[model samples]
Target: MSLKREVLYQKWRPKLFSDVMGQDHITVTLKNSLLRNRYAHAYLFTGPRGVGKTSTARILAKALNLEIDEHGEPKIDSKISEEIDKGKFLDLIEIDAASNRRIDDIRSLLDNVQFMPSSGKYKVYIIDEVHMLTNEAFNALLKTLEEPPPQVIMILATTEYQKLPETIVSRCQRFDFRNVSNSEVVKRLKVIAEHEKIQCKEEILWFIAENSSGSLRDACNLLEQLSIAFDEITISKARELFGIIDENISLKIYKMIIENNISELIETLQDLRLRGIDFKSLSNSLIDVLRLGIFTVNGATEIQGYSSDFIKNTSLVFSGSDSRKLITILEKFIEMISIRTEHFDPLLDSAIIHLTYMFENKRIIKEELNQTQEKEIKSPLNIDTQNQNKNIETSENNIKESKINDTQSHEKGLEVNQISKPKLDSNEKQDWEKVLFDLRRAKFGKMVLGALLRNVEIPKKLDEKLVLKFKSKSLHDHFKVEWQLELAREAVKKAVTKVYGNGIKLVLEEPDEEQKNNTKANLLESDIVKSALAMGAKVEEEKEG
Candidate 1:
């Protein structure tokens, strides 16, 4: 049988300081130090994994043990270099601290530190994942690292620098390797593909780079894996291997949400679930496209893997306002997904429903505001009043017009979402259920606001201040947004006026444990509350006009 080829990561490992990609800050400093013959005895290399930490350490070892040219770059085609590559070099000892992390192992290492180089100029010890060493082992290694023999150089590499002792870290010159950018990773992959004679598309390289998460070795390995699996690498094959959802599917879902087509959106999500699409990937892809849409709205046009036509279409589908709202909602959805849960299907359905409902309601509210612009019902928060007299006239006209519209709407079988002109008799009691019922018919997307208030209760009712407490923390958090709080206050103002014959100041709060228990006990004791609870409530969905 033919000898198996070495893996791409090993085959394409950096050999010289100049060859390390995307970490010029560390490499340049090391090169200058080497050239000046002022390199430290111990070094600490810290960064994310697969970003050339070990390779850089090995290269440093080779430089220290071998003679370098005037440019401070050691030739890699020598006998020592070959031996180092094959792990046969006596002077260059690479240890995986993860496995050999006991005090005995470190003591043995300290015993070896006193010896001179057997053949090379200096003995180099590279301890990788150095943070995995036990407390005793770290303590044993500290004295040696602080003052090693003149001929010995200790280089420590760890992904987690925080786990390392501060005393050990303070003894060495630290070099932090940065992640390889996608563009740099793609450029490096192109060089490799050309060298290996692999047939692949540029987009496929980009796909690999994106999924590798800034690790050049991961990108190279993925590219090699694809080359071996397929005669020619393609996007479809790569996506299938990685379980990545297609961008078209993500775009379609975005379109459905923008168009407020909830039925089709749910059907599409169900189809993807049936076909075993990774929901996390789908969510991430949609977030990317929505981000792209925001960029397009702001006149950016160079997003990768997406055509100008796609950008143009995305801009048309997701307006600036739509992008902002969808992004906020999707961010929350993704956060919920991040916390591992078994009921992902139901969670996804609920998220999609929430997204579409919020989008549709905001759009409807915008349209209604535009249609009523001629009436000039200026919100006190948005527009400045000319004076008290003008404000009073505006308020009186608004009340009179609302009364007339309420009467006319009753005739047309459309209930006006406003306070009635007359109040209840003195003997009649105010009803919380009636407030919620009236809220459902309030104007300017108050129906959506009413749905949010479904679990709200008056845990602490004070005169002039209505403390509406939320049972669901999520619902309570929604009101923390400034605009949502304003909308809630407006809906409550109308609903309370219709039910209690006057509007009170609104105070939104989350129910504490004691308040929650007290509210529950009060609900059980009240006949009206019990009857309302038994009857239950349904949110009034906005109908197409």
Candidate 2:
């Protein structure tokens, strides 16, 4: 029979300091301190789950108790390793502080600490989730902790250090464990896969690593589950098994949101719902997708395993400002979902509806801005206003026309003043392109320029009005707030004026229904499916539109 997962975990688990991955800092410090005969009476090991806090605690116990060779060195004895491996070390006592969180438990443990060890120089007590201990229990343990028996060592481990009383924390030597990086997790997973004789793709492991969110235990658990689920561990199979949303689908969602395809987005959501996907997970996945889109738009190409097409397409779909807006929306969605999940209320429906409505309104505003810019370009305004001054000389024709066609000429002059006129020579165009190129090169500039290029359409003539269109109503509405739109407009104006002189008016618009509906439908289908898949929903292909 194949080895049980838990048994395998026991067999492959870090047996020594060197076996633990991605926690070298903690391990090395402890080892050095132990070797030098400088040992803390109490240690507080805190971090996120599966980063090796408990494992390190156990290792410390073994390291402290085991005999050293004549060279004043701790021998890497297999017998000691075996005893610790089976948890039969009489001197080492492991306790789940979560369940035994009472004064009696602490008193009992403290009473036993006074006695001489049955074996080895030190008696080690390893308490997991020490933060869960009651105040009375902590108080009882405090006196003993402050002046513990020289032979006794206390190792306290917790995921949430903040929950523990400050007094208790101050008394102990603290060592923080961090979440394992994706690369580290991937590396470990690859090792496990090799040992298991499992055929797996690196991308699949990468996905597992990403989804594990820095928890080695979580990644290992997921890998084990997937290995059991699939006979051949391919990337596609991993995606299906783990409910990973495809990058393409995520990109589609970004486009839909940008394009403001509400109906299609809803339909896509419904499709996901039908596939037994959790709404909360879907929302979270969408947020991650948006985050990735934002990263791509900002030209963060170093993100591991992000597809070239995803980066390129997302860069085209979202501007920096647009990405910020999407982030805001996703945040709100998260908030709403969190509140809904926590407390059942009729107001949640209203909240979702209001949010959706605002999103649509933003799209409409963007369309309107785009249209305004277009109209402004097609009909350049020209106006002239004249005031007669006794000290000034004026032409007779101007004076005559000022009186006879004052209203029409004034209106025409106003129109001309409002309309932007470009005076760029070929040299100027080249200069402007260079400026654009430079802007694209800088990190901040790339984000700004990418957003501008995606959302704002520049006219051929330098004098023509600049039109800014948004794919989503939410973004359009968000753009109206404070200096966001103004800043973007100013940036473009500055760039143009630097090269071609300042003769252009900038206009922002929202598109018409027909175009929006069509775009929205296509975008919604793509994005929803992508987002769903990313969140780990299984997608079944249907007839294409």
Candidate 3:
């Protein structure tokens, strides 16, 4: 007979409450309950796998049945601990509800619940994957659950709590287990590596922790696999074996975006694909990188699995707002990749092309702005005179001039410059409205436009500064403190310049208290408010009194 390589309970598993990593609240509560003899008849342990759901259940069982030694500490006797460890305990029944989900299985189990335990004090039943039980089986178990035998204790574990029936859930004491933190997972992995005498780098263990995504069992399993595959664990070998994209690739992609190198980005993606890189996984990895970039921008230096070079390079390349924008783009790409398996290569190509084009467009706009500013500083009078001359023509010329003038004027101000909003004729306002409507329909455009709409107002006539009134000084302060104000100001300038002509200055102002009060009072006296009041309905004013 061959001995299995499976981990035994005593060798690696946590023996006491304090030994369990990453579940302090749960362990503490469970220990108090066992110490006070306030154990529940049924328990529902739900969380991501390997965060100590089953392990906690077993520990609870041991605390409940095991006797105290002469030293006044609980004694895990070799015989009882071995029986429980091997799943051979007469009173401890560990059932996989996933495989035995029939009503008959529940009935058979419930039929045996009447018998008293032969040795142990309590009949501990640990039913894993309890969510997989059939509706019929759930109903069959409900009666016994509501009133189980005096010696019976049930610990039901499931990954999906939503799948369980409400009746069954209501009868059990539920504890929600959360995903382990990156630090906690790393800490546990370090202990495991040390125990196995594995010469693992901290970076390698951190990678395993991050890749495991908060599952300790998964992390341990990955570590064990890596240890067996290589004589010693190295960061380079782990990245290769796991098919993880090198941090250099992620940094290069970010640099390409920053430098507006669409061709290089596409070529890079092609090179990676040729190396048998999984586009979907690569996309996901890109999203993670962007996410970590965001955290780094926020001054978080303890992100799991990130190399020192990655941190330093990402910090150098991305500003806070830039990281935010990248996160948004990566999120969109992730959603696109999730549903798109067949067209992965094409999709990757499209994403690279789209991002490259975006970067190029931004670069062009920035260069144009810089040139315009230089021209303004050097020859402000020339720009004004040329724009005025362009406007002073026949009706046809005026139309052409308006188009040219608006394009030139708004070029310096549009934050996200995708379209050229031309001047309107008789029905052009309606067309402009349609264009705005379409822009607002787009996800990114909508967010930017929505902010502008809330904060900015248009007035009739050119050279007349547009008024921007905010609801709160905090909003005004935030806009001023962040680049959002500059971005918003530029967008409005573009829109106005597109509609009017060059040399239009749009001013953002904070309205005085008197003006705000008057505006609020007028709104209260408006027909809408009066009509609602006339219908005997109570209406509270939204604006300050």
What's each prediction's TM-score?
Answer: 0.69, 0.66, 0.69
Q: List the residue pairs that clash in candidate 1.
A: none
How well is each residue in 417-458 modelled by candidate 1, as lDDT tens digits? 211122222122225644654555443421254545666643
* Predicted structure 2, TM vs. truth: 0.66
lDDT values of the candidates? Answer: 0.71, 0.64, 0.67
After TM-score superposition, the amount by which residue 221's alpha carbon in candidate 3 deviates from its true location, in angstroms, is: 1.2
Question: Candidate 2: minimum summed lDDT over ten consecutive residues — where?
Answer: 397-406
Model 3 has an lDDT value of 0.67
Candidates 2 and 3 compared: the better one by TM-score is 3
TM accuracy, model 1: 0.69
Clash totals for all candidate models? 0, 45, 1
Q: Residue 233: error of model 2 in Å?
A: 1.1
Task: Encode model 2's per-residue lDDT on 141-186: one tens digit a residue.
Answer: 8888888989898889999999999889998999999999999999
What's model 3's TM-score?
0.69
Q: Output the worst ten-in-a-row residue range by lDDT, candidate 3.
A: 413-422
